[model samples]
Target chain A: MLREDVTEAIRAAVFEELAAVGFARMSIEGIARRAGVGKTAVYRRWKSKLSLVLDLLTAFAVEGLPAPATGSLYGDVRALLEVAAHALRHPVASQVIPDLLVEAARHPEITEAVRATLLDSQRGVVAQVVRDAVERGELARGADADRALDLVVGPLYWRLVVVRDARLPEGYLDDLAHASVAALRA
Target chain B: MLREDVTEAIRAAVFEELAAVGFARMSIEGIARRAGVGKTAVYRRWKSKLSLVLDLLTAFAVEGLPAPATGSLYGDVRALLEVAAHALRHPVASQVIPDLLVEAARHPEITEAVRATLLDSQRGVVAQVVRDAVERGELARGADADRALDLVVGPLYWRLVVVRDARLPEGYLDDLAHASVAALRA
Candidate 1:
């Protein structure tokens, strides 16, 4: 296999290992075997298991976060929700996230990576969306943007990921978008 | 030690083991060792590690959930949020919950226990509060009680547990309660 193909295969194997047996039990040798690569190949790419996992998580975090400019704050909020919902619903992400969160609590280095790469990037995207909304006068001045951002994205995470309720009802997103707007205004 | 004392010791040890190594690595022998009890003593109280964990989780779930009748819907909502916030903020709970949630996704038996003992009971409490609000004319007729419940409790979980943001701003509960009511109205 080419270098890029080998890299992709390793990534896929890592996710599978994460799903099958969470982060605590996942091993570098096991990941190598699953990827059909030698231990040397895995070690060449990543100095340690932590580095590999962090790089994968960082890559996932930075992918496809578009700051939606949908004319109205309401539309922008809905657009953002759509992106979040899709990501949370991804099969690997749905499983990996909860496990990683627990891992983050235990490992400070992982926690730092999550905060810097994932959480900071997400916060930046939402902040930009809120900033645009405020400039357009759709949102009132001095609204707590941070808290409003939490309200906007919190429900989907709660219902879909935390509660493990995968089957979202039809129009749930629309209703959630509307509620998020209402919460922001409130 | 008396039988009750042994059981209590075993329970405490299980929590410590869960915190130290997480659920995937937690074992009955480890728990017994930590509790200063024999393995047979641990087994006598509970058939298996899963059963012991589930029982402890069920006990925690049923401990202190009261649907506060605070006359006003707003007050009731805040009360419920307070209860949820307190539980989520508990030291052991803050750690164990995320671990158990991941475990639940992999294990059907844990999933069922969580649904029946924890999620359903919490939902029932929130539903009762929403029902009272609607009957008192504080909430509109035909409001989506289920979605409203999600809104009411989602932010606290997102902020405290998921994001691990333990320091909520002053009057955060009031703001959340107000936003929830707005979401319900919307």
Candidate 2:
């Protein structure tokens, strides 16, 4: 395989392995077999199963939810939620996220990796959005960005991922966006 | 072992095993070994790993979050977040809830089991709490209970479980409870 193809193939295999067997049972051999590459190829690129999974996860996260400067806090928050909702709706993500979340609890190294990559990266985007709101004077200064982040992002995650496939009312994201804005302003 | 002792032992084992290895790697034999009983002992009590986990999860769910009738919507919502914050802080739960959530995505039977037990039971309580709020005129009538449920509980789960040891400023739950009520009212 070309170098770029090998890289893409390995990334695809890791996501599938996570979906099929979850993090605890997911193995380098399984990933290699699924990718149709030798285990050596897998290791030649990434040093271990943890590093490989984390590398792919970091790359996926670095795809980065767009930070919209829609001029209003409500507009920015809604756009971000729409992007997040679409991403969480992916087939592999719904399986892989909670699985890795479980792994993070068990391994300190995994915990730090996820915190630095997924958690920090997402929080940074939201904080910037919140900063935009503050600058607009739509939100009071000194609003807790962390709590605001939790409020905006959490419900969609709960409804979509943790509550997996629960029937949603029409315009669920719209309602959530409104609710999140109210929460932030309050 | 005495009959009740056996049952109790099995229950404890399931929680620990879930915390240690997660749902994917957890097995009946491992549970039995950890519980210091034969596989027959586990089998006699529950038909499979799925049932055992579900049964225990139901019992844990049935322990039920307090739906505080604190006379107003704000008071009640805050009370629930406090209870939920306390519950999610349990080390086993921080691990096990996400594990089962992942399992639910892959297996319809497990999905149904969790939905009926965890999702339904919790939503039922939150629905009743919202009903009280509407009647009290704290929140407007015609609020969406499903969205309300997500607003109240999601942030706590996100902060404590998924964020997993993110540092909090003082009175984090207080800020969260306040934000949740604002969102629900909006």
RMSD of each: 1.7, 1.9
Q: Per candidate, chain B TM-score?
A: 0.92, 0.90
Per-residue C-alpha lDDT of model 2 across residues A63-126, encoded as one tens digit per residue = 6656788888888888988877886787545777777778877777777666765567778889
Q: Per-residue lDDT tens digits of candidate 2, residues B1-186?
A: 899999999999998998888888889999999999999999998998988887887787666555789897877887887777777788545777778878776777777766765577678778889889888888888877788889988887888888875465688778778888989887
Error of 1 at A157 (Å): 0.6
| Top-lDDT candidate index | 1
Q: What DockQ values do the models have?
A: 0.77, 0.78
Candidate 1 whole-model C-alpha lDDT, 0 to 1: 0.83
Worst 10 residues of 1 chain B by lDDT: B112-121
For candidate 1, lDDT tens digit of each residue in B1-186? 988999899989988998888999898889999999999998878998999989987887676466899988788888988888888887555778778878887887887766655477778788788788889998887766568767988888888877778899999999899888888878
Interface RMSD of 1: 1.1
Model 1 lDDT per residue over A122-155, tens place: 7877888888888999788767766876898889
